[model samples]
Target chain A: MISLKLDKKLDSSEGEFLLSIDIEIPKYSFTILCGDSGAGKTSILRMLSGLMTPDTGRITYDDTVWYDSRQKINLSPKDRGLGFVFQEQALFPNMTVRQNLAYALAKGQHSKEIDLLITEFQLDGLQDRKPATLSGGQKQKVSLARSIINRPKLLLLDEPLSALDQKRRMRLQDFILKAHRDYDLTTIMVSHDAAEINKMAQAVLSLENGKVSRITRPGEMKKVSEMTSGTITKIDESAEELILKISLKKKSGNAFQEEYATGEMIWVSKKM
Target chain B: MDWQPIILTFRLALVTTIILFFVSLPLAYWLAFTRSKTKPILEALITMPLVLPPTVIGFYLLVAFSPAYQFGGWLESIGLRFAFTFPGLVVASIIYSLPFMVQPIQSGLSNLPPSLREASYILGKTKISTLTHVLLPNIKPSLLTGIVLAFAHTIGEFGVVLMIGGNIPGKTKVASIAIYDEVESMNYAMANNYSLVLFSVTFVILILVYLANGGYFNQISK
Candidate 1:
């Protein structure tokens, strides 16, 4: 299990925002940080990947302390054995595809793995081509292949498929899913797309206003749907009171309505 | 035709270009990446030699490196001499042609995306390795341009080499200095021969540069 307890204040020249998040991710599960832009979703991943230092935090993977402010210990991204795939694809334009993959493989740790990755990612014929010559989808695939060539313990993807078209996005998503299954990686993906979140995330963690407001399990949606259906919710403007006539069927359904006060904006949807 | 000066000029240019390649790489790297408060000051310093008259730089070098100066005295104590020597001429040429070496490299490094460096860092490569294996290879064309420009510029340098090296034949005399000497000594025929050779050499270099830069010469010729 990887436990991350981050209570940090992020203040650039822009302004100060507090990020307090406490979450435990079971090993080998696909976790999604689902939020809108500017919600500090990428910031969290940056912290986890050791790209950004938090003001205060303790992040531990199993028994290893990846970061601990009290102890003044922080591992670098390379030492942490984490792979990151940036949204920009970040391929080295000078290197050929084979050289790029070989760069990630440990020194003297060569095998048939590179050829396998090239073939697996459908980059067989494009090994000699530079990143500038490759298409957007091809570049992203190369980036993915390069990141996973080392078999990192964790994979941090920041909007990996967001740059592609819809068809390419779906194709890359399927590739990611297959890679995740094959490696059983502890994966953390950041995405604003709700459909992507639904398809890939075993647990959805929503970040709002620089804080993780919700960490819901997969089955919570069924219960939320069941509860929302049975409540007769009314807002009384004179007293500013919310009245919920909760019957048995209404009790299981419209639970979010019960939890939220009347006149407070909430998204109501039927069970999908 | 006496080929000694021609050989001497090529040697000087080749040495100057090689030395400038090493010197300019770090300068270009810092100019491209650093956001320090001193960056603009350093950049101005590097470009100052380009704007100033070569005679001015040569005058300063002659004074600072003369046998009477403290630095020159110290260099003499270490069994080294600077003024009126081939090495002195090289030093003067390098200073004279620094901008030609640095500007192209600086532009190339600046135009490169920073994401490439960040990606190398993320892949666990150290800064030195990233520079050697990643950044340098990507900027190969710029390095080539810098070398060609510096070499050609150094080959044509006259004022600085004249002031510091004093046109000693077969010792400190390069083609440009020799050409001046020939014209001064009423050897117009030899001067013209030297001029033709120098012109052809320079023309070929310019042609290569234009062709490498993707047919700019063809468009201009048209």
Candidate 2:
């Protein structure tokens, strides 16, 4: 299990606030941190990855002390042995896709694993190309692939698919899920997308009033209100069950409740 | 016509550029990434050469290099002398041209997305490896600009070199000094030759850098 009691002073345009949370995540669980923008979701991921330090806190992951306040011990991200994929892709612009994956290889590790990753991620054709030459989806895929090259046990994903299109987002989500299970990773992803949370997370933590609280499913999401209007952008009849793809005013998610047709206006209410 | 000055000038420029490249890499990295309180002070000091006259630095260096001064006496104890010498000229040139080498690199490093470094760190790479393999490779244009500007700036130097290295033949007389010497002796033809070479070479060097960085060469190659 991974446990943390983190305290950090934060600044937003709204003003200064304290982010304090005590949380435990079971090993190999796909946990998602859900919150609004500037709600300190990314901050939590950064703190967990040792990218950001928490003020006077203790963090331990699976028998290893990642950080401690009194003991004054903090492991560097390099020694923490985790994979982090930033929203920006953050691929080394100078390295080709193959080299980018190869870079994450630990000292004395085999190079053949890079080729396996390339073939697994279906990046074989693009392996020799630099990041600057790749499309947005391709770059994100490469970024995700490069992160797990070392087969790190912990993976931190910060809005990894937020920038992609609807189709690319789904494809990238599959890639993430595949990596998550295939590598037996303990994953913590920061995302506000309800459908993503529903699809990926086994346990969800929502930040409210500078604190983290548990939420079971997307049904309890504040974003899905008591009643809302949306146009049915797509109606998939191919599946055994009918699925309506509705585009709401502020956000979009699949409304699996009732049968609907394309271009139909419908009212969506919070089930609970 | 003594070609010794021209040869010596190129040699000095080469040496200064090489030394400055190595010295400024770590310095620029620190300036770009450090949260230290002394950063502002060091940054101001590095940039002082940009605003302050070369003679200001040259004057202090001249005094420091003189065997009469304490700093110079220590150097003399080590069998080194800087007053009116080629090494003195190199020291002066490096100080005068420091900003040219450092600013480009510092800005380049600062402008890269922080996530790049963080990603490398998460991949368990040390700072040095990340710098050489990732950061430096990504900022090739900035490196080229730093190297060329430092080289050209050293070649075009006159004031600091004149103060610390007073026109000693085959020792401290560089092209700029040679141009000045030729013009003072009414040898306008020789002066014009040196002037033309400096102007043309610097112009070509600058144009080439811009073209390469602008992706003109890439376009052509494609």
Candidate 3:
């Protein structure tokens, strides 16, 4: 299990906001951090990966303390034992695809494992090619393969398939599922796509204003009423009950209206 | 026809280029990656030599190298003297040509995606390893440009060398100083010969640099 209680201050053109979240992630589950832009999804990923430090926080992974602000202890990213797939697909431009994978290998891993990954990712003839020469989908595949080649304890993927086509996305999703289960990786994927969330995530954390607004299982998400020409925009929950706001200008004449128990969608619904 | 100055100039250029490569690597890394508010101030200070007149720099360097100043006195205490020596010429060349060595490297490092470094770190590579293996190889054109520019700039220096080393024969009388001395003595033939050699050497060095990394410029120009 990975646990974190973090607070970070951010300043942007939109204004200042605090990224404060206290959460625990179960082991070997694929959890998706679902949110809109600037919702601090990437910030959480960075903090977990040890790429960024929090103002005040304690992050412990399976009884190993990763960070504690009061103790002034923070492990370097190199020591965190996490695989990260960046949004930009940061392949070493100078290295061939094979060399890129080989570079990511941890201490005891062998060269034969890289060959296996190369074949598994359908990167046979492309091993000698540099990243500059590869297609976008190919590069993303290589980035993903590099991340999991080391069999990290946790995998943080930041929109890893945003550049792939529809067909490629499906194929890679299968690969992701196999890798997650086969490696027993505790995975956290940052994505806002509803279809993707439904296809892959076992659990979803809905983030707003740098906090978890709701956490729901993918199986529990309710579908929106397709007959109604309206979109569910927000879901507000209280101790009493759940409130869903659907944007229905045609029916209600207002931009949005809150309905009690007439809810068609949950927060971060798999059924968009 | 003193060939010693020509040889001395080449030697000085080679040694200075080597030193600057080591010196500028860390400095360029810092300048490329640092987010401190004082970065602009530090950059401006490093680049001051590019705009400042070499003579002014030389004059100040002369004062700084004198035994009277604290820095110079400290050097003297360490059994070193900068004034009127080959080492002094090297120091002068490095200072005058620092920006030539640093700017291209800084620009190269800055042009790379920050994701490259982040990925390396996430894969458990240290900053030094990432720099040497991942970053340096990608910035080959910039490294070549920096090395060639520093070499050529040092070879062509005049005012700084004149102020600090004062044209001492075989020690500080580099090619540029040799040309100046020949012209002062009314030896037009020797001066012309020196000028032609220096000019040709510089032109050939630049031609080689451009040929190897010329495509980089062509792409930028487009």
The DockQ leader among the candidates is 2
Model 1 in CAPRI terms: which quality?
Answer: acceptable
- How does model 3 score by TM-score? 0.87
lDDT of each: 0.81, 0.87, 0.86
DockQ, per model, reads 0.47, 0.80, 0.66
Candidate 2 per-residue C-alpha lDDT over A1-272 given as tens digits, one digit per residue, 9 for 90 to 100: 99989899998668898999999888999999988788898999899999999998999988899999889999999999999989999999888888898888999989999988887788979999999999999999999988998989899999988887766776678778888988999999988876677668888999976688665654565454423345667776542324466654532365444432222222222244
**Per-model TM-score (chain A alone):** 0.79, 0.82, 0.81
Number of clashes found in candidate 3:
0
lDDT, model 1: 0.81
TM-score for candidate 2, please give it.
0.90
Best by TM-score: 2
lDDT by residue (tens digit), candidate 1, A89-146:
8888878999999887866667688998987787989999988899889898999998
Candidate 1 vs candidate 3: the TM-score winner is 3
Cα interface RMSD of each candidate: 1.5, 0.5, 0.7
Q: Model 2 chain A, poorest ten-residue lDDT window?
A: A261-270
**Quality of candidate 2 docking, DockQ:** 0.80
TM-score of each prediction: 0.82, 0.90, 0.87
Local accuracy of candidate 3 as per-residue lDDT tens digits, A205-255: 998987899897866754422212456677777653344555532224543
Q: Rank the candidates by DockQ, best first.
A: 2, 3, 1
